[model samples]
Target chain A: MDDAPAYSPTPRTRATRNRDRVRYDAATVHAILDEGRLCHLGFVADGAPVVLPTLYARVGGVLYLHGSTGAAAMRAARDGGLEVCATVTLTDGLVLARSGMHHSVNYRSVVVRGTARRVSDEAEQRSALDAIVDAVVPGRSADCRPADAKELAQTAVLRLELREVSAKVRTGGVNEEPEDLDLPHWAGVVPVTETIGAPEPDAAMAPGTPLPGYLRTFTGASD
Target chain B: MDDAPAYSPTPRTRATRNRDRVRYDAATVHAILDEGRLCHLGFVADGAPVVLPTLYARVGGVLYLHGSTGAAAMRAARDGGLEVCATVTLTDGLVLARSGMHHSVNYRSVVVRGTARRVSDEAEQRSALDAIVDAVVPGRSADCRPADAKELAQTAVLRLELREVSAKVRTGGVNEEPEDLDLPHWAGVVPVTETIGAPEPDAAMAPGTPLPGYLRTFTGASD
Candidate 1:
């Protein structure tokens, strides 16, 4: 299992060799990808590189990303046959140190690189669209309106198989130098957390409408 | 002002005709940079490209980023003389639509491309460290212990001048097709938000020591 099959011709990024920090196992990679709702995608467009933050969802081994038909970055991904690099990060806390040099943040991040292709099949696009919907709000695809034929035809969905993926994470208390530990400064994790607040019902909602159970189920941060 | 001074090579990733979105104005560029705390730094390392999530802070016309002194990505940036592309994004909300195809998120993001140089000057490094501290927690730099000589020498800081930067944003309701407006699907902004919760005092804090005002002043999400 250590000697896995090589996936692509483009050599893996040199940073991939940090084997201690890089997790190549499928379960670890999927866990990070599944929990993240948004990804920052980087690709070279024209001559200079551009990084665009976009919504994405993982289904099986592929990641489905879609955007407006008019978005130039989306258009470039569809037409240029570009190699796309993507990352998703979740920051858990702020590590405050006795010394400024030791300050850091606790975070989990995954980076994947692959060639993206537009999802061509109608049935596949529909499934990918549903995966995207469910990615943000579990079981939302059935409760919400599904895409009609014409709308699906105009929007573009690109599929990048999660072949070359890795997750890197850093967590825990401040790592201060031994000499500075005796200083009078405070040193600990000032935990940074994300949580959902009470839902603000739309002003125009009809009198009889009630919020969905799924909405009620969101007690803490999703990612 | 329309015909600004041209550099050797025009920004190729910039959309030629979308001048309004492609901001050359330094004020507009810095505003985007200042508003966000994390950035996605992209570069071609070895042959394939890599993107890493890291914390960054902007000051004057320069951006400073730091990572583990042993991180290969930072080493490459410090030694390989490669151009680096970095971007920061703030997700305002999730835009759910009646049609799956039209579902999207509202966000503000900035992208910058330039060659990065290792910061070596002592005064500048200290100032850069201060900018990062102030970026996360205003006035905390003054309150905390400053880095000692040995600690300062172990850290790596890189500077990227904000000479070429652009911001692209999408906000408000989903742009649904005309015919799908009447569809029975729910359509509105889910209104994603990030906010700071009550700070958890360190377990080792002196009994009854009051929390600092700057920590109490965090009413919004830092990320």
Candidate 2:
């Protein structure tokens, strides 16, 4: 796949030169996207720029994003093919340094650019929704209430083909300058971890409803 | 402020819609920026798109992002004045539903569009670094080691002026369909939070290095 022709506009941004941080292989890009639950989408609206935060799921080589049918962003994308830029990120830790200059955070993220189209076909829409359901909770669509025709009608799903994508990541200890190595102040990584705590049943839940095993089994997966 | 002349661009793309979800008042935009410690930046390279996840700090109306002087994205922006879209997000909870369709997450995010410029002045570079330090720990800049001139020379800081910015936020419980109310499965938000844990003293530190009171007094401040 290394020799596969890249998408036409797949030029790396000038700042992308961090050879050590950029990941060009498809698997790395997909891994970052699969593990992320939310994405920030940027597109040109009117003569200005707009960014929306929304839930997303990946299937094959495309990503699906949904919003209210009446949302302006959705309307714009559906009405006119828009060049969309979307990004997903997962922060891993806070790098606390002995010097103020070196304080930083470690993270992984993926960005994609493509023209998004509304998933108009009913069959495709349903499939997209299924991908979203499974993306949030594996095997969820099989266990829970499925979306009926009415619910599906109220939501708009946009599909962005992930033809142009890249992932960047940073990890490890703070980079302390040699001159400041002798400072008495401490320097190290304050690992940031996401944990799934015990589930809280809704007040309206039935008395006998037991917690789903899937919920209990989650060990704070990145997504 | 509402009447301030909006920024305009040449050859606007379809993705730049002026919608509520992608548009925000100045205060809301600033709040989102202030509460985030990292950002995912997106831009087209070659013909493909790339996203880089990195630490950032906001000062007044400008955001400061830094990387090794050799990064591609930074070099692209610094040399060619590339257009970039960036996003910052904070996830607040996990919304688990009785049905697969309802699984979702609640979050707050901000997206901005602008051309990034390299911070060439030495004083501004130092100040930007200080802002980054203070952004993570309120009183850290004064207490920690300051960046020396040589160390500062190797880092590159890019400033993105907050001219065209928007913030979108979703907070609340699941919006279950009326018909699914009686489902036997549990439904509610599992609040997710990030907090500072007890600081572990460095192994090489002197035995009596007192834990900073500030580290112990964390109030789960947003960010």
lDDT of 2 by residue, A1-223 (tens): 3333332335542233545877756777777888887787766544334455668888878899876423566776678766777788877777777877677677777778778888889899988888887777666666678777887886788999887777777777777766776788866666666655555666678765766666656534232
- Residue B6 of candidate 2: its Cα lDDT? 36
lDDT of 1 by residue, A40-158 (tens): 87776444456667678888788887653236656656676557788898877777776676677777888889887778888998888899888876776876667777778777788
Q: What lDDT tens digits, residue by residue, belong to model 2 across residues B97-197?
A: 76656677777777677888888898998889888777776656776887777778777888888776666666767767677888876677766766564
Q: Which has the greatest TM-score?
A: 1
What ranges in model 1 sit over 4 Å off? A1-22, A67-81, A197-208, A219-223, B1-28, B67-81, B201-209, B219-223
What is the Å distance of residue A67 in model 2 from its true position?
A: 4.6
* Candidate 2: docking tier: acceptable
DockQ of 2: 0.31
Worst 10 residues of 2 chain B by lDDT: B6-15
How much lDDT does each candidate structure score? 0.68, 0.69
- The root-mean-square deviation over C-alpha atoms between each candidate and the true structure, in angstroms, is 5.1, 5.9
